[model samples]
Target: MDKKGYNTKGRGGGNVNEGGDGDKWSRWWWGLSHRKSAPSEESSNSNQVQRSPSQSKSPKQKIRISSRSDKLPFYYQNWFLVLLTLMSLSCFAFALFVFLYLYPDSIESSPSSTSPASSEVVEITYGTVLKLMHEKTKFRLHSHEVPYGSGSGQQSVTGFPDVEDSNSYWIIRPQPGTSAKQGDPIKSGTIIKLQHMRTRRWLHSHWFSSPISGNQEVSCFGGDSESDTGDLWRLLIEGSGNIWRKDQRIRLQHADTGVYLHSHNKKYSRIAGGQQEVCGVQDKRAENIWLAAEGVYLPVNGSE
Candidate 1:
């Protein structure tokens, strides 16, 4: 009975020892699994931290690209506005230049035919500015500062073809020792003096032979204060009107020489080319007829 009990106890003790060893092996396996799991979790956390920064920077880069694209339209729009402004200014300047070039008469204030003061028929009075036109030759009596090459050697006179020449303008004046005033009416047989408007000279004639016709030399001589009997001219009215009218045909007879102002088809060559010669003739021919043309005539008794 005792041997049987000992065997039973020994078997029981062996069973307890096997149970302790199994417990220790199970604990070791559990610890090894826990350490491996810890390493895997740490690697996963590190990977998440690195990916989070890239993800955060991606949105900022997208925002930067979107901002650049949004500004492009505004930049082009600003340049377009500048170009439009420059084009508009250039067009305005061109238009202003064209306007000034087309209308030059708006600034000119000379005595033209379209002037307001020369639109009506007015009487020829003393101090009246006028142009004398030859009836037969259709030339204007003109004079300049040029001296005659031959004959009287005074201020040369000619018949100008152009009606717009300012040199043809003459101011009618009374004789130096006459009672006639500025606005007085001129009679048919009145003795008058023609004063050049430009040079202030007087129409004069002398006994010297003419250069072309060899009859007499008619020229412009003297000034506002210097005058002689050679500057005098007698008006011979052809029609019946006692008062000299603008439409009346008349003849001028020199007071010094018994000659009339004449012009022919003969033109000058060198000094006054293409201009008709103005001279004096003893005969009262048809070439000596003259009529008053474009002028600033004074009103008769202020009734223009």
Candidate 2:
């Protein structure tokens, strides 16, 4: 109603709300200057670095482990293997050293190149004096001047308590000597017949029970022929078949029966005038001990 389309103040529409218009134009110029003065935010963001999801958080650094062998160069890998081998060899050497140090005595005492000769058994030869001393009473084997046998063949064998008695001396010889002479030591395993020096008969045993010994094996004088193995005697010295050591005990094995010569107890009241009864036994006992001596055969003049 009051000139609705036309403004008449200086310029076009300059009269209508000049204060508001002036304010609006000032705000617009200020915004435009601010934008021109500062750099664009989008352009700044593009220039700055931007991390991807995979590369964030320090890129997840890989863990690393190193050992002494790993520090070596690629060319020295074989040398690392050689070093391990050397260490294994050193362990073996140390083990061997411990073994020798712990068992020194065992190594020395073992049956080696060197040993004492005294430990070995000595072989006995023929013609050596053999003294068989009794292990208990020190008695000896002896023969008396008694006579027994049929018509022309008779002999005597006796046991004595006193070794000093002349009849107590017996010689080990291959054959009986007719004259009085010292007998030589017979070799071991020599099958021989023991002859009584007084009666010149071999020591013999038979199936007949001993009259004086009460049903024991009868020990009598053997004839000159010695046809049977019963008259044969063998001296065993500690299983070696050789002369034993001094005071060493022995066993006299009979060739016929393989029994050992044994002595009975003195309690046998009738021991034929206090004479010790000698019999055959399997094992060696105190009574079997006899002090053997090297003596001459003093043959009785009328014994033959």
How do the predictions measure up, each by TM-score?
A: 0.62, 0.43
**Alpha carbon deviation, residue 96, candidate 1 (Å):** 18
User: Tens-digit lDDT track for model 1 on 170-274?
Assistant: 999998777888888889889999999999999999988777777688899999889999999999889778788887899999987878989998888888898
- lDDT of the candidates, in the order given: 0.85, 0.51
Model 2 weakest lDDT span, ten residues long: 122-131
Clashing pairs in 2: 132-292, 133-291
> Mind giving the per-residue lDDT tens digits that candidate 2 earns over 168-272?
433344534433233333455556556554444566665544434533353546555654566767776554435433333466777777666766544224423
TM-score of 1: 0.62
Runs in model 1 lying further than 4 Å from the true structure: 1-121, 302-304
Number of colliding residue pairs in each model: 0, 2
- Indicate which candidate wins on TM-score: 1
State model 1's lDDT. Answer: 0.85
